[model samples]
Target: MHIGLISETFWPDINGVSMTLAQWSQGLLDAGDQLDLITPHAHADTVGLEGIPWQDAKPFRHISASRVPLPGYRGVKLGLMLPKAAKRLWRKSPPDVLYIATEGLLGLDALRYGRQNGIPVVGGFHTNFQYYLHHYHLQWLTPLMRAYLRRFHNACTRTLTPTQAKKNQLLRQKYHRIHRVGRGVDLSQFYPRTTQERSLWRQQHGISDDTLLLGYTGRLAAEKNLSQWIESYQILKSQHPSPVKALIVGDGPWRDHVLSALPDALWLGELTGEALAIAYSAMDIFSFPSMTETYGNVVPEALASGTPVIAFDCAAAHELLQPGKNGDCIGVNEAEDYTARLIHLAHDYQQSPQRWRTASAKSIHHLGWPTVNASFRRHLVQAIHEVKRHGRQRSDFVATKS
Candidate 1:
């Protein structure tokens, strides 16, 4: 099968959607399927991201769209390809299915072209753009944005979200044919380090082995609710009996702001491959305070590395966090509750480190990439079959008229 993936984000962009697409595309390629990636041209500065096998001179085709820097977030770009441009690229060798992974203009053009040409199109709900409006001082646009998103996804053959909670939420908002498609972490790539290795890593970072190292991975954006993350860490550092330090991974438009607030934190900007694994393994606990996520991939990645997480009860946290076992999930937008839970978890870790470590490592062992990719492939295939069935019905009606 041939698949065309349309997204504003792709490999080399340090975000969940980019990473997830890279993994899924690799799975499709391994299963003997052809792919064409449609995304914004990678900027000259977008280097040192996790390398993908197919990013350069790989089997799949690459198509670049016209792009502009997103307002207020110069580090990210939005893409758009005109309808004629899309047609010219796919006139002879169009894909069997089209996956629209972002709701930007690029994806909008792809959806229009796919529908006009009778190609199957599937949508992915990866980010909460509406919730982000509040952070950007555009809360007045929330209802309009929500309506536009509903219309956009509803036009697709099916809309796939990363968690059941999101699917239920979209369904409540009158979305059609919503499906839950979860993500997976690479067990081999994100497992826990040995005791000695963890100790050595902490030593290298100027941290004592016994000190509690709290970490936060992913973009340091306003939507991530990072102010609260900083507040929680400050509270812990001041009051906790054990020494507490923070490790900040990844970078974004909010980099300067985060650095200003956390001058003492160890800032490891945008690591991938083995280095990222070590960052996760080196931490004693992980905090992901973002309530505005379709699914927080960092939560699982941290869990896979034996780092228990404290997050809001939404997205991937709602599905993966086992409260007392793996980590704790606070109520959505409950700032005080989030800080309390993080402190409580830290105390629990001090009491019984082995229990937390074992459970965190074992909790997500079932979420292998192969299983997740296979299920996603099946969904895409089903969309193609549905299009074919509809085509056959239309042909039969014409034949009866003749």
Candidate 2:
């Protein structure tokens, strides 16, 4: 099938949406399908997408849409609508399916063109924009955001969510044709490191073998609920007798806040590829306090690296984590409970480190990128069939009316 994948976020943007969409694009191409990647032209120079196998061997096109800096977001841009450009692109060679990965201007334009031209469109619900409102002091926009999201997604043949919990939430809000396509971890790239390698990593950071290293990976932003993470870490260190150190693995607007609050914590900035995997492997415990994740990719990456995770009981944690097993999931918004869990986990680590590591690795062993990519392909096929069937029915109805 010829697929057009549209999103404001793509390569060079170090976020979940961009990474996942890039994987999906390669998956479609590997399956002997054509893909036209429609995204903003931001960070064009930094887009190191040549490493994707399909991009080197298959028929793939990129449509660069105009973009401007997104308001209130540091180093982030929003794609502008270009309906005329979209029409021209599709007029020459229309896609068999349109996958809208975001509800941004670019996605809306693609959705409109797909609808007008009778092309099947599948939307992806990747981010919790409604939850992000409170962080940005735009709580009043919650209702408006919800309404817009509902209308935008409902217009598509189906909307794909990254977690079952998120799909259920969308269903409760009256979202139609919702489907769950959870994210996956690249096992080859994010696996546990050798003991010597892990030791070297700790040594580089001036961390001793006895010290418990707590890690958090992802954007250090307000929407991530990072303040709570720092508070929990501080509480854990205070309560525990063991030497505790923290490693924050991403960069964002909240850098200053994190630095001021946790002065001794190692800020590794943004890391990718093997370096990121090594960081995950080096951690004894991964604490993710974010409450707004659609599906925390870092959670699985940590688990894949044999590192126990502590997270709020939502998103991927709600789905993948089992209390007292691979990791602990604190109740939603229960800050005290979250901190308590962190302390408890630290104690458990001191008791039996090997057992915790084994459990963590075993829990997420099934999450491979190949499996996730196949599931996504199936969803696209289903959306295409639904659209074709509906079109046929409409044609028959019109003939009967005539």
lDDT of every model, 2 decimals: 0.85, 0.83
- Summarize candidate 1's per-residue lDDT along 8-92 as a digit string, tens digits: 8887777888889888888888788988777886533223233563433245667667889888776688886633555666788
TM-score of each: 0.93, 0.93
TM-score: model 2 vs. ground truth: 0.93
Q: What's the lDDT of the predicted structure labeled candidate 2?
A: 0.83
- What stretches of model 2 exceed 4 Å from their correct place? 42-48, 51-59, 83-86, 392-402
Candidate 1 clashes: the total is 0
> Which runs in model 1 stand beyond 4 Å of their true positions?
42-50, 53-57, 82-86, 392-402
RMSD, every candidate, angstroms: 4.6, 4.0
Which ten residues in a row are the worst by lDDT in model 1?
Answer: 393-402
Error of 2 at 199 (Å): 0.7
lDDT of 2 by residue, 209-230 (tens): 8999999999988999887888
